[model samples]
Target: MKFVNVRNAVALALAAAFMFGATGCAGETERIESVQIPGVWTGAGGGRVEFGDDGRFELSGIPSDAVVFSFIDPPPKGEKVSGQGTWSVKRKGSIVGLIYDSTGSFAEGGEAGTLGVADGGDSPKLYFSTSSDREYGYEIHKSG
Candidate 1:
């Protein structure tokens, strides 16, 4: 009778653990799905980035005061740059990185940046930082 009781207790514990584990996994999946980038995001200084489900992206409304340091003799300051390119997302641990490829006149290169999500009521804000060292980057809000 003692052996049977112990076996039943162990089985019940295992079943409870499995149920909780499955629930936790489902919640994680919902979080990841919520973070999917497939909408128009507007940022400060009139900056905007639209990410399509088809992997195409459009960036525009960059402030002229923004600066971009290059290998040229004199680093050119950022202008009201706009471009169309392809984008891809990579997940490194818990961080989501966005890889952008520009094919516009402003520049013809790629940049990798980290994405951030804000917890502001119903509309969650999305932010993009070009450089990790910079104090201020782009703060974007989803338009739709």
Candidate 2:
């Protein structure tokens, strides 16, 4: 009986650790010069900003000035909330992994995803996934 109880406790602890570690924004990698859009950039059809390290971002279309998970602790409703945290680059097949803060919260936290940097003729265009698997994304160009 004692062994059973100890085993259960260990299992529970492992589960909790797994969940906690699972919640993160992105990973860390070598820095690469990406697009920097100073102005506001919305998502596709206005769902939410996918991924970018520039300006305030939100999922509800509400504008903000805070960068890297807006200063608002709880975050506002409708506005999914997003901000630019530190990120690095890693090569995975044809896609590049943009690893930001793993512990970040809000739109930029509790998740690990990717954003494709497509060539926009003059500059590289940015597209990020909205869902965990990265089904849809938004197009953003470098702000001159």
Candidate 3:
């Protein structure tokens, strides 16, 4: 009887350990916002964009909706164009790429290289650069 009881106790302890190990302390979807993007960034052609974790987005000093984008900038306040698409990230060393679909009133959608993100208070702002290097940088503000 003693041997059987010890065996059962050991089995229970092992099972509990396995369960805890399988379920980590934090969920995978829980995004740990790191100091990656936050400050102001320039975009294509003298365009200015700001990002805040406080749930606000401004384009050319006008509040705007969170429209999906591929390469083009979000419609500048009162533009008929509305961008809808998906965005993915590819990383290599200190560089990142943002690829997306330019659906809805866009010319063509494809892969684009990510320049860098400026880490700021609460939210990190995403930035994009042009191949010509002459056009102003583009900023990606966070959406609520």
Q: What digit string (tens of lDDT, one per residue) describes model 3 on residues 1-144?
A: 676445434533443343233322323311213233333434433344443344232334222222233334655664543222332222322222322334444445541323333333466455443322322134555544
Candidate 1 regions with alpha-carbon error over 4 angstroms: 1-35, 64-75, 92-96, 109-114, 118-122, 130-136
TM-score of each: 0.52, 0.37, 0.32
lDDT of 1 by residue, 1-144 (tens): 676445434533443343334333433321223336678988777888888888777878855343222211212355565666565443322223343344543343443334443323466565443343542345677786
> lDDT, candidate 3, residue 92?
25
Q: Model 1: what TM-score?
A: 0.52
Q: Is candidate 1 or candidate 3 better by TM-score?
A: 1
Q: Which 10-residue span in candidate 3 carries the lowest summed lDDT?
A: 23-32
**Cα RMSDs of all predictions?**
17.3, 11.9, 18.8
Best by the TM-score measure: 1
Q: How many residue-pair clashes does candidate 2 contain? A: 5
- Cα lDDT tens digits for candidate 2, 1-144: 676445434533443333223322344312224344333444444434443454233333422222122122544444443433333333422223332232334433333334444432345455543333332245454444
* Candidate order, lDDT descending: 1, 2, 3
Local error of candidate 2 at 107, Å?
A: 9.2
